[model samples]
Target: DQQVKQNSPSLSVQEGRISILNCDYTNSMFDYFLWYKKYPAEGPTFLISISSIKDKNEDGRFTVFLNKSAKHLSLHIVPSQPGDSAVYFCAASGLGGGSEKLVFGKGTKLTVNP
Candidate 1:
């Protein structure tokens, strides 16, 4: 059972355009949402994240929003650059109870063209 899902397999955006990536989850037990970015031949790097208690979190050009009632989350990258192009994965964990286990979505490949 895929608890987390990234419906879109890929997304393309022009450089300097806003890129929005969406994610959904079926598991209501998740209390933490995380976004990770992975480059070719490299491990997934930690990106922005949001807690179940927070509706939104922003860091620089990246922002993450969590809608607990809708069991949905999204990542927004403003003025997307080519360097921001990567496979973005959405992950969730029951961090509220100290559980380290994480459920991840299949990921969406983002291509930002100049």
Candidate 2:
């Protein structure tokens, strides 16, 4: 029941355009939300994150917005670049446990066309 869901398996956008990815979760105990970007054959790298207490978090080109009431979250990349083409994973973890085991979605592959 710890499934975090990313409905879209892929997204494509032109360079310098905005890219949006959506995610949902069913577990109410989850208190941390994270997004990770991954290149082929490489480990996923942390992007942006928001705690359950907050509604929005941003990091340069990346932003994450969480709506706990609906159990939904989204990631936005503004002015996407060719370098941003990669798989993005949305993850969540419960607080109070030092265990950093993150439950991840299948991932959405974003291709930024130049």
Candidate 3:
């Protein structure tokens, strides 16, 4: 069974609009989240992150919100730009587990139209 899931496979948003990407986890032990953006040929690049202890974290135009009780997390990008169009993946890991490998969800492809 997949521990992490991005139910939506694709999302489209107009430039300058808000793009919200959602992820869900089945493992409560997951204490951290890493959102990565991948272009067509390059490796995934870190976008934003959040720890289970905090409900929200923001950086520039990107914000991440965690709802521990619901096992859900979301990444919001305001004023979405064309450069933001990519495959976004959600990876989760335990805060201090010796060997709990990172669990990644199937990415959601985001298309930002200018």
Candidate that scores best on lDDT: 1
Model 3 TM-score (2 dp): 0.94
Ranking, lDDT, top scorer first? 1, 3, 2
User: What pairs collide in candidate 3?
Assistant: none
Off by over 4 Å in 2: 96-99
lDDT of each: 0.93, 0.92, 0.92
Which model is ahead, 1 or 3, in terms of TM-score? 1
Give per-model TM-scores.
0.96, 0.94, 0.94
> What is residue 14's positional error in candidate 3, in angstroms?
0.4
Query: What digit string (tens of lDDT, one per residue) describes model 1 on residues 1-114?
Result: 899999999999999999999999998889988899999899999998788889999999999999888999999999899999999999999867425888899999999999
Ranking by TM-score: 1, 3, 2
Q: On residues 1-114, what C-alpha lDDT tens digit does candidate 2 reach at each position?
A: 547999999999999999999999999989998999999999999898888989999889998999999999999999899999999999999873325878999999999999
RMSD of 3: 1.8
lDDT of 3 at 103: 88
Clashing pairs in 2: none
User: C-alpha displacement of 46 in model 2, angstroms?
Assistant: 0.7
RMSD (CA, Å), each prediction? 1.3, 1.5, 1.8
- Residue 3, candidate 2: Cα error in Å is 1.6
